[model samples]
Target: MTAVLDEAIKKASITWVSVGDGPAYALWCMPVESSLIVVTGPGEQHAPGLTSAPTATVRLRGDHGGLIVTAEATVTRLDHAGEEWAEIAPQLAGKRLNASGPAAEVVARWAATGCAIVRLTPAEGTPVTAPHLPDDSAAAPPRETPARVETRRPFRLHRVRPPRT
Candidate 1:
C-alpha cells in the first residue's frame, strides 16, 4: 500500500463509499491490518449495494476534513462463521461507537440480523491524490428520507397585555 493511502486509512474513522453507480454513503469503518472493515445492515449504517458490489470507490478525508484520496477498492463480504469474522468482529465491535450492548451481544445481534461485514481492499493502481484531485466539490442533494425537522413558532418571553385590566 502507498504511504499516503496507509496514512489516510489509519487516521480516518469514517469514509465515503460509492458502490457501482450508486450515491456515495458515509460509513464508519475500522482499519484492520491492511483493509477497512465496515458493518451494514438493518440497524447499522446504510451502505447500499456495498455487500453485493464487487468494487467500490472509497474517499478518505484528511485532518482538515477535506477529501484527501480517492481509490478503487475490491469488496469482500466476510462470512459470519469464518475465522476472519471471529477475529475481526470483536475488534469492530470495540471500535463501534454507542453500541446498543456489549461487544459480544453486538456481534451476536449482527450475526442474527444478517448484517454484512465487508472488507474494502484497495485495488492495484495509482489512487487520485492531492495535486491531481478533481476541481469539482462533487456535492449532491440530500437523499429523500422520512425524517423531518418540526417547524414551530418561536417561544416568546414577553406578550402584550391590556394595560393591567
Candidate 2:
C-alpha cells in the first residue's frame, strides 16, 4: 500500500493550513505537484476560525487505463510555541514550484505574506499508498507501502498558546 501512497503522493497536492493572527487559510496544491487532476474536483472544506488550525483531507485518485490509486490526507498548520512569524516567512517562497494554477496561486499568496509551506506529517496509523492490486484477483485487496508520517517540523506563522482559558 505504501507504493500506492507514494504514487498518490506523486499525484497528491501538498496542502497546508495557516493559522495564528488572522483568518485561517486553506491552501491545496491542486494535484499538488504535477499536472492537475482532470475531471475531479478539489475537496476543500470551510475555513477555520482564529486560534484554530483549518484542516483539509484530500483524496487523490489516478487512473491510467488500468492503474487506479486512492489516498487520504489531512493537512494542518503547525503551531510553533512562541515563535515569531518572521522566522518562517523566508522558507515559504523556497518551496514554490514553477507549476501554474491553484498551487501557483497558493505559492504566490504565501510568498506575498512570507508564509512558508507546511509539510504534511502523517500521524500514527495514517494511511499510505501502495502498488495496485493484480487485475486478475478480484478478491485481493491492493497492497500498501510501509509509509508513515515519521515526524513533521513545520514552520508556522503564529505562536502556539498555552491551554486556552
Candidate 3:
C-alpha cells in the first residue's frame, strides 16, 4: 500500500486536495515516508480553509471525474529552530519555488510569518474510485450536426508592402 502511494506521488508533482467543505485546489506536493508534505499560507501558496479541516480529498490527478484518496490531515506549525525543524526545513526548502539564501534563513522567514506544513496521511480504506463515470450512452445526443458560434476578432487584418533597398 505504501509502495503504491509512494510511486504515485513520485510521478505526480501536484495533487488536487480539498479540505473540509472547501473546493478542491491544486498544491505542489512532496512525498515523505508514508505521508505527503505540502506548504501553504500567507506569502507562499494559498489553499484556504485547510487548517480547520479534519480530513481532505486528495485527487491523484484532479479526477477524470473519478479517482481520489481521502486522508487525515496532520498540521505542524514550525518554530524558528528545533531538531525536527532542522531536518524538515531543508526538505521543505528544496521543494519551494525561487527560494534564495541559506536553508536556515529561509526557514526562519517562514517561521517569522505563519506558514502551515500539512502532512496528509492516507486513510486505511481502499483508494476511492468514485462512482458514476460517464459512458457513451450517457453522453449528450449528437449536437444535431454541431452548432458554431461566430466570434469577432479583436484586430483587423491588413497587408503592407516592405520598402525596397
Q: Using TM-score as the measure, which candidate wins?
A: 1
Off-target runs (Cα >4 Å) in candidate 1 are: 157-165
Worst 10 residues of 1 by lDDT: 156-165
Residues 6-48 of candidate 3: C-alpha lDDT, one tens digit per residue: 4565555677777766567778887777667777777777777
Give lDDT: candidate 3, residue 27. Answer: 88
RMSD of 1: 3.6
- Separate clash counts for every candidate: 0, 16, 0
Tell me the TM-score of each prediction against the true structure. 0.91, 0.32, 0.65
lDDT of 1 by residue, 34-142 (tens): 6789999979999988999999999999999999899999999999999999999999999889998899999999999999999999997858898999999989998
Instruction: Report model 1's TM-score to 2 decimal places.
Output: 0.91
Clashing pairs in 1: none
Weakest lDDT window of 10 consecutive positions for candidate 3: 132-141
Report the Cα lDDT for candidate 3: 0.64
Total clashes for model 1: 0
Q: Write the per-residue lDDT of candidate 2 for residues 91-124, one digit (tens) a residue.
A: 3333435434454464345445434333343333
Reference-based lDDT, residue 113, model 2: 46
Model 2 TM-score, all chains together: 0.32
